[model samples]
Target chain A: MSLGEFELIGRYFRSMELGNAGGSEHVTLGIGDDAALISMAPDKQLVVSTDTVVLGTHFPPDYIPANLAYRALAAAVSDLAAMGARPLSFTLALTLPEVDETWLQSFAQGLTDAARDHRISLIGGDTTRGPLNINVTVLGEVRPRNVVRRGDAQPGDLLCVGGPLGDGGGGLAVVLGESMPSSVSDAARDYLFQRFWRPLAQCELGLELAGVASAGLDVSDGLIADARHLAEASGVALHIRLADLPCSAALQAWPEAQRMEWMLGGGDDYVLLFTLPVASIRCLEVWASQGFDVTVIGEAVVGSGIWLDDGQELKEKVQPAGYQHFQRKSND
Target chain B: MSLGEFELIGRYFRSMELGNAGGSEHVTLGIGDDAALISMAPDKQLVVSTDTVVLGTHFPPDYIPANLAYRALAAAVSDLAAMGARPLSFTLALTLPEVDETWLQSFAQGLTDAARDHRISLIGGDTTRGPLNINVTVLGEVRPRNVVRRGDAQPGDLLCVGGPLGDGGGGLAVVLGESMPSSVSDAARDYLFQRFWRPLAQCELGLELAGVASAGLDVSDGLIADARHLAEASGVALHIRLADLPCSAALQAWPEAQRMEWMLGGGDDYVLLFTLPVASIRCLEVWASQGFDVTVIGEAVVGSGIWLDDGQELKEKVQPAGYQHFQRKSND
Candidate 1:
């Protein structure tokens, strides 16, 4: 209860083992120093991203520490994945209300699991006393030529998503104790919960799409909202077919209207959404054959904004809608 | 009052100008994407540090947003100075309770001034809604051979400080409305306040000290406490001559006892504390001639803890004491 900052950091963070990647070769000096020193590969450029999650705003007040930790790190690392970068290291700036050893232990465990899964090293961090807030700054590397950007989508590019959508939103509904139809099975509920709590970064798929995909980003701000960003950035229009949007079996248990809303407007799926030329369809086949759940649910056109095409003959222009941190009361 | 996150970021952060350094050549992509891309020089290793300041904990709740922004960044960047790294870029993770355009404008102005002064570019950041917290992750680079470390001190190495100490604590007192003696002029009070609010990182001195100083760190954790860290890290003892410790003229106006306590135990004086070999004293003279206030204050010894000599036969071992975030009720 009366832990010093140094002791808390030493016990919970510094001594923790890194994931499968172990210590990074780039690390010259790590935790306990004024700054961490990292050596870089000569041919690689660094990719960096920062993400902050706050209690009550980013997650429910009573969320599990371990799950929150895992989700936070994974969500941050997903940026690197979106950019086709390999994980290198991350620093955590954690502000907590009090010194709770149990919470710290669980949080550390969750971080360890996430780090291992992501193959990144924990280089350094700052621990402070305040409201519960976690800021993760992830550093990664990619060859300059292999790096992907949002502003390179060609007009005729095929718009694709790495995997299923709507699961994260559905999972959030389950977490919030929203009433599920009596027909929704316990296994489906469990699946949705897992999707919400442990959304994996599509790193491998992103890497494969590096030179192949014209432009890409992770589906964090819902399929339609995020696609609009890519469209605007690349000066093209995105046409997404409602029938082609992939949904997990768990999410499919919901009504068609609810599933469509979650798929198009709900956020936090962490799957890669990208654009590739028609020639790269073979690559998609290769990926699909290799057990990747990549699906082409849209296309890039010469116009602007986003369009939704139902199975019917009608096509409607849709406004971008997703979780905007300041606009919304709370966010994922 | 109801600004979206993107609009807020675009208005305040993305459009800010860099200091005299202008935009960094290392930046390939900045601000708009999922991640910022930075190309690094092959021969130089990267150095990074993260620091967080929370409202009510790190500063008074009613603290000015601009001053807080400037102070937060300067303090964080001081770590790069401590490591003798050249400024490159930084990312800010900011959480606020509400969208106050007036507060944001002032804060952004402060950040702009600090960025320009430090010659670092803002690459990317995250804006979230929550209790006020600012987390800055700074990235810099240094050649492999020119790097300094805390665990490299040698016995008989002369201990030196970059400049005067205790002004920060004295200034904090001024900020907190502490009563000052009539003998302390308004000029002295102003000087103290500036020291607390705008402590410059001794970056030029730190860069010069690389390879010259056997070991070093910025004195943010008080003189005696920080010396203990250097001593322990290097497996040596540090002996300080009480008479030799430097105090700012403003701080000297206080009673000798209070001045000594602040000089010995006060935090947030971002001056470089380092150990130099006796053979390197000429370098110190060169630095002094160049207007650096470098001063020898002690020597590293063969023992294992910090010892204080009051210019007499009696030498007493001193316990390390400084602000620890978790242990203390509030911290700077």
Candidate 2:
């Protein structure tokens, strides 16, 4: 019989352990048991989130297995970053049409690399036979009082982003051959592609913002939509200065309208959006000096919905619609 | 937009909390946030397991939504029982083809009931748009020293089962219209069907067996196959008595050959199969007296593989192949 689920896991996934960041010390028992045993840190509350990536729905079908694995892990772990939590471990439920040795090796390598970099261990998971689908449940921990929450945003708090926007969406558009800027440089195109294929979680910046920021969330479902999520949760309005959006050099090559669309509607950016008082400007300057792309985009106000403004005379009430699943076909 | 992923989750899944499972005491923050926060119990190691059920692979597409939800949760939580852990909380990643309110309501109701009965809170999960898939990551807790592992069996250990098996397979056969026994009563047929749709996790029994049993695992794939797994894990042989195999009244109504096949090869029973020392006979008696269907069906030996024996004189080596996904098309 071709490798059964158990044998496939044993061959490819069982030995992928965590290194650095306390190498598997948190795990009492790993795979090969009914369930993995995890030792939780005292004085820390466990933060848990799950995300599923369906083939053809989440990523392009032509993507390599390694890129797929990396993107999937990055997206899921990004939620922990939003919560300002330290990565602990994760479980993966993988369903595949068939077993491919080369694909498994590449995927495992990508997953192991990401897990190690994030200081998370592969505690336990399930492998089954079906249409390709990957569900990752990531576990992290943070001090109860220090956890950044979307509902904690306060009026007059400055809204900031840890990095640039629209790169992932631009990359996807270029990859799909639907929208391409004729004047875009080859380097810009390559950079955008890498942004989509392997986005950073901005976890360290999130940790830095834990006590400084009032509220935060990861920008996965586009800036406008995710900002609206924070606004609704915090029961406040977000007035965003469209001119202040930090767009990457690659994304800026697109037409103004196209660039705006990608900035507001792009998904998979995986950047942290947080709100903090003006007193945190010193912290922002420090981060900027340390080569982090931090930008103040707007401020929380005493109302609901989003208000968009330009540095010039242009001002408008923009509809907060982003890449919502079931409503949109793709991320952009 | 017809139900964005977030709205669907808020409408259908977010409210499905466990009332009896400490009423979210374990969850410091449930749902809504970027990630859920869970408070871990002290002096206990957490047990985590993930299982994904895909449409047209794990179950029949025509099955009711409620039954599907119940079976999925039961199967995932059964792993915790095998590990002798108390159910704490679970996260579900559900991907559906369309937004059907009736279907979501029914599924959520079934899932809620199961979670309440199992004492597991619905901490957090993800709802997305895609083909029908349900991935549940169950978290539980057990004392490290009392964990029932598959590798702890010893020679001369008495192998036992907590309850009868084969009803689920018979029920599945009936549901698929491949089996009809004239001698089976209506109640028998109903019992078999219920067994398949809502198998118990045997958590209470597993907890009781933790400190008393030498080794244990949930019987998911057929008895012969699961026994072989235990044997391999423990580096020993498991000798099972064919006549001693526990069969429910509903399953016994089938022909002798069919009954034997279902008992030995059927899957999804979710009963605990464990080994204990001969000195633990008193513990077995105590459990049996308290209405647990504990039965010593075999013994472990100082070798590998599984041996089947009939009370008379028949002895044979049984091939351990049962419910291997991709290898088998369906339960039958």
Candidate 3:
């Protein structure tokens, strides 16, 4: 039951309805072409973002192709979440050295399942032979003027997080075969692994907090780096109480400095780091009543530099911060 | 002499002044963060597209990194051209085994130059260490109702081309070192080589033909495969005269079958294929009046199928068309 390119597309890719996000009635044409064209909501605007995950860099060589498909879409869609936008449509351009039916089936399942869950439709893209890579370009819907941005933080706004950090970052060590403490229980292991392996984009949270939050960004590099972006963009300062930094139970047994290292510098945390008025804490609680939780980590202050609870005046974190490819020097 | 990712991006990618297209005014936030956001045009819709080019698949390995960058951007931009859209922004996700300063500079230069020409800003994207691959996503602007699709070809429309074809296909053979004819004089060699190396995207013609052409698409795969798509989508028959296939003068000395193969099945021909009414042909002469050359290659008839002159059928050309990665069945 092997299929060539056309047949493979016909059998697995085309049959799946990709543009059913209640916007299909508006889509003149969907997939199966050189490109796709669709209209945005009449009252809303369109938001677009793209992310590419390359094998061995974004994931280990032994990473499952199926999960790769899912994670690639997740990482790209997370940008829309950071902007307080609703998932709409995505185009996937996947490259491979060769094709394997089983691998294709699993990969397609991940790609389509995520699309369905997010109410997005497959649009248009290209396929070619090369090293394995998945680039997902996603289009989302946002209110005409309610989208949040990194530059909107105010002096009195409290800095908050959508969930626990360092899970994805710490989980990478496990993937790379680095040994850590045993207090990171098996339940903690599964929790962090799932966080690292299949991160759920906080689209709902983003939209919910759109008007309430002054500034926001997805934590991909690390807490320190992303926190700095928010501060720099808003022309304010961020003061993170080191003791308030959220961590999974996995870090309880590690030395304080090492645990702080993972919490501060471990990249891959896709959680949303944002700032809002202290009054919004009640609104956030109401959001948590709806099943989405948020943690208050610190606050935006009337200052010019980032700070830690230890009173360590952090003038600079690092230049050209975070996970970079063309930086000439590797972050890790 | 040493520059980091931020400095590299500032010196090259951000050099494009997106203010020409009005995207800069709407960029609530630009590059240098989790993602960049652009405000949707008030009256026009947003068009998004993604394309991937592998080292040995789209371009020969010997192709310089800069040209490869320019060529990939050109290929993707051709899609927006088919839709008659205004270029807005692009995201480049580059994957490589290792960061080569020379390669990065050249690739960035090509991308920077192309973007400057079209005023397409480089938005935010990922950079990862892995196999060499580039995935580019482009967003463009179009009137809410003016998009052209393959499904819009009319039964009695005149099938027209934006420009000459087969030049790119023949150019690829030279790049691949598979077929270099001695008869193709040295004077024309550079033209053919450049054509194959950096084929232009028909964005201007596409935007100009929005209301003039009935349907449209770019020739990434061969003409036959794409023509079949146009015929099937429109539910009409396309009748192309085999003797009427266009070619560059350098390729004129090639054998008839070789010429046909290049014209029909040679992928990477980024020319725009479109349909217009015989009555509308006179109107398109406005392009010629504007100093742009247009070619008429075929006509659409009532029925579903694409045929060549001499009464040959498309099925006779082979349905397992174009070059697939698995065509070579490489296990590695």
Fnat for the candidates in order: 0.70, 0.66, 0.50
Residue B99 of model 1 has an lDDT of 76
Q: Which candidate number has the best TM-score?
A: 1
lDDT string for model 2 (B1-332, tens) is 23354576576777776444533777888888889988876678888999888776335658888888888898998999999998888998887777788898899988987887787888888776667788999988888888999999999999999899777678778676665868888898888878888887999998898888999999887676678778889999888888888889787778877777677767678899999998887998799788889889989988787777842222233233433322332211
Runs in model 2 lying further than 4 Å from the true structure? A1-6, A18-23, A310-332, B1-5, B18-23, B310-332
lDDT of 2 at A95: 80
For model 2, the DockQ equals: 0.54
Give the best candidate by lDDT.
1
Candidates in order have lDDT scores of 0.82, 0.80, 0.73
Cα displacement (angstroms), candidate 1, residue B13, comes to: 0.7
User: Across residues A1-332, which tens digit of lDDT does each residue of candidate 1 receive?
Assistant: 13354576567888653443743877888888899988889999999999998876345667888888898999999999999999889999998888788999899988988888888889989887788899999999899998889999998899999999988778888887889888799999998887888778888887898888999999887776688789989999888888899999888678887787788767788999999999888998899888999999989988887877842221223233333321342332
Off by over 4 Å in 3: A1-3, A19-26, A57-62, A174-184, A249-258, A278-282, A314-332, B1-11, B17-26, B57-60, B176-183, B253-257, B316-332
Tens-place lDDT digits, model 1, residues B1-332: 13354576567888863333633778888988999998889999989899998866335556778888888888998999888888889999988888788999999988888888787889989887788889999998888888888999999999999999888778777887788777898999988877787777877888898778899998887786678789989999888988899888787678887787778777788999999999998997799789999989989989787777853321223233333311332432
lDDT of 3 by residue, A99-217 (tens): 67788788888877677666677776666666777788888778857788888899989999988777766677666667878666777666666777778888889898777898898
Tell me the tens digit of each residue's lDDT in model 3 across B114-178: 67556677776666666777888888888957787788888779887777777877787777767
Instruction: Assess the local accuracy of residue B46 in candidate 2 as a C-alpha lDDT between 0 and 100.
Output: 83
